[model samples]
Target: MGFLPITKEECEARGWSQPDFVLITGDGYIDHPSFGTAIISRLLENRGYKVAVLAQPDWNSKKDFMRFGRPRLGFLVNAGNVDSMVNHYSVFKHKRRTDAYSPGGEAGKRPNRAVIVYSNRAREAYKDVPIIIGGLEASLRRLGHYDYWDDKVRRSVLLDAKADILVYGMGERAVVEIAEALDSGIEAKDIGWIRGTCVKAREIYMDEDTVLLPSFESIVASKKAYAESFALQYKNNDFITAKRLVEQYAEGLYVVQNPPQPPLETLELDDVYGLPYEGTYHPSYEEAGGIPAIKEVEFSIISSRGCFGGCAFCALTYHQGRQVRGRSKESIVKEGRRLAALPGFKGYIHDVGGPTANFRGPACKKQLTRGGCTHKDCLYPAPCSQLEVDHKEYLEILRALRSIEGVKKVFIRSGVRFDYVMADKSDEFLRELCKYHVSGTLKVAPEHISDRVLSYMHKPNKRVFEEFSSKYKKINEQLGLKQYLIPYLISSHPGSTLKDAVELAEFLSDNGFVPDQVQDFYPTPGTLATCMYYTELDPLTMERVYVAKTMEEKKMQRALIHFNKPENRELVRAALVKTGREDLFGKLLRGSGRTQNPYKKEPPLRNQKEKTRSSGNRGGQPLKKSNKRRS
Candidate 1:
């Protein structure tokens, strides 16, 4: 229930000569369920293991790794809850100024590739100890993956780190199995059959039931092969139907990824969440203002896991898969009471949701046994008729939380799938959401408005969003409550061209919505969209797609979303001219007619007639002659 030992003095104070496992991480040690290191270490301790944490250790030398004095079990390493590359750099590959996971919001606390660096250091400190790698970075890069930062395909993290084993996904089950095997005298290299793990093999020794993907050489040699390999990897991620996948590397070496372990059932998930977490950063960080990351999730409850809404731009499908699982309502309410009892209880429970807020059970009954459909998405193009669309259990849980004595309001900050809401035959959930849960502005991701772009993103069409918007407005009107929908949009996603950007801009203008923040498509590792960004071909269809790779084009695409801003006039104008879309130039300029141009020097105009035409047009609506004054 207390904090794990992070120093030798603490270990000695616990009357222990040595710890069982020295868990190393990139982020500062925050003993909270929201942190992967906290959950795994606490689970190990609960199972009668002495776990010492070495968080954000100095990666330059082996001295820090030796502080634990060689754990009896082994070393467990992770790049924290987020990928190291993403944590260190922005989507633009620029260095980030702050790390919420570090003390004092400092940068450069960990190395660029922390897992690889830490594992090699552990080897140097203790030559015979087993090293295991897990968490988001290792899980997503378990196989050869396209690294956007490096602009090339990199080998598996296991290979680069030279670790004995790699446990991918939610690794509670895998790590326990690994510990038992290791404690029973099984060597790390010899233990290869465990589920949700990846190990390097010296030769091809897989059984008939295993699936073989394209060799690393072949994928690196041909983009088509890489796409094909990724498709196979994506399809075989389900626990019920997945098979062991093997990919060959040079000199007869192979990386074997065992089938993913089954998702935890209601009771198992409840037990996992009920683990005794200190619920905040370690006291040592108090002097440096603590880990800022804990503030977001300090009072929130993760009620569920996995998402059926498979967006190409998201990595959840590859990491968590498509099956949905939830804890019992009793478990969630108990956590809510605990949150309400915290010292700074504000009577407001920040969130009671996970990957997707509204999802309570599996997408459909068939998925319980058959796993998700390999050929089709659960909620893309359209919701499957077989999809189970109900929010009864979720509503009940929310009601129970609200009834708790100290609880005032429970807000669902994690996004709800609006399309899923529209799929429901009843409006009870929508009404309750607007009346009780909304924090004035509900944030939802519609990504882009163009169906061409949406199709590539594997998101629901624009019509679905429109339907949801209308229903939301009607409910608000009926309740006499004023709430707004803040939609999250993306620019320069694969299959988006200047024409598509213009279409999305027109949609935003019509809706009178100017997003304060816009997300340019970032091609992180292991997502389907990242594959498309690197290959310029949809892995599913093998069709060529347009990609805006140039900085100027991407800036223009992002600028189009906020075309009403005076500063973005020149970028919008350049985009229109380059795409031969001069007709849209008039609409962009006239949408919010302003006199002051932000450009220091005026560029030459096309002609007097062009200027006159632009002044008279108001985003396709004819302006009165008296209102035709130019800036």
Candidate 2:
């Protein structure tokens, strides 16, 4: 079949009595590697299992779920690449106008808490089918986590969706294992021994290898217990040294999570990405102008997976794990040559990066064998002494890609770790990046300026960003390039006081840098920052953190970034007055006269990886996504 069967007719064309699996998704079907639904479906098909695709089915009734009837094995459900709630709503809890994952960039195509709704619908369609749920939404909500929308602790998605088993993290390995066991006639509830899976149980024989977290009732009853629970979940994410973790929901009921599956090695990652992908959206979606999300990755190549650049608001720790993995250069080059032959092959290759572009390998040699240190981060308060910051392999891969027959330029659009760049003694990689990779402007996330806020965000201090800026400027000057650095900053993050927001505004004013996009702290699930947002205490430190909870304060904090804008004068004034820094208000707001604004217009972004659109949440892709929410 050109694409996986999305209808009963297509399934019949495949000459199969029934599909072994029906993969339900919230996104328009685009059989690309960046999509989790594609990888799992193709992998199952390659393994000789009949897999059918069901993309964004109507959720009002069970009619759409009956398109393929019941699968022989199970129903694999995912809430697209992004969390449905985050996709549908902004940080201000306002509804988003459009969705990139849907055809025609439409909104309301998928329901909120899509995994739960789809799972329930699947049950209504087939009362006795084995339902398996995984993806960014399901993975992050595998256990009891802070639900930002509900404003409280919600139980595991496994419970809410009534799923038989929940597969967390990258599901390539665990998915196959589950399929084999199910094919062997094992019940979903009994197939709980596999790694990277969570299953419900009535009783457990406690052992030294099992770590029990505080019960859900205890957490809901006490914020201290909730913080402690989050801390324990944070520490056991490593594959090598992690043990079985259990969370109690009721007296006899429990959710048991096995240790994470190991990261895929070079050849393994190559096989996963080397599957037969149709590249573009399914032909049926052409009438709707195709998926807007595919535009970002159609010309791009994923060279690696995983990240060690620990940020508090990021969900990578729970999903991809900290151990990084890279595909072989040969595999990447092969994909590039194939992309070059495609009908819409352009002269430029968009990106050749993954979670973190420059991280082609593990943080250090020790991570491969012993795993990351549970109590320490690879790059956070400071770069670890054992960090290996060589970028030779990544450079070689980029060179090979750009040298392809039809390739003109290769870009690294997935973002880079500038702190890691500074850790390297030699500036060879920096020089090359400035010379070829940068498209006039390189966007990097500095998150916040104040050391007080930076501590809570797990980002490097302001001085580190300043030094990197200086080095970047010097390197570009030597290369005779007119490049600029777009620093990504956040507002209203936990522990960010009015004084700290004023400090950030002052820094932006002094540097003549007016950022068009400012992210108010979005409290998504399975993040340290989200935990802090709910508990008002740092999960790791258990110290009380100041949270900007009120809507007025969040708006005021965001207004301070662009204080010179005439529309933001009143909010900026309020922020300054609240911080008791009224003395500098005259200097900061001096240009708020009838002259309209004082800042000059920025130069064209020149087909750069990202730019500050009219609204970062709409129109096109945003520049720096500090939070990692991929399946």
Candidate 1 global Cα RMSD: 7.7
Any runs in candidate 1 off by more than 4 Å, and if so which? Answer: 590-594, 597-631
lDDT of 2 by residue, 1-631 (tens): 4799999999898787788999999999989888898899999988989999999999999999999888999999999888899888877666788888889999999999999999999999998889999998999998888898899899999998989999999999999999999999998878989999999999987999999999999999999999999999999999998989999977579999999999999999999999998887899999999888888888889888888887888788888989999999999999999989988987888888888888888899999889988888888889998998899998889889878999888888787888889898999999999988989898888888999899898888889889999999999999889898887778888999889999998998887776645687889899999999999999888999999998778777877877776556666777787788987676677755434232333233464222222223321122222222211
Which clashing pairs does model 2 show?
none
Error of 2 at 53 (Å): 0.8
Residue-by-residue lDDT tens digits, candidate 1, 410-451: 998777899999999999999999999997777788989899
Question: Native-vs-model 2 lDDT?
Answer: 0.85
**Displacement of the residue 379 alpha carbon in candidate 1, Å:** 0.8
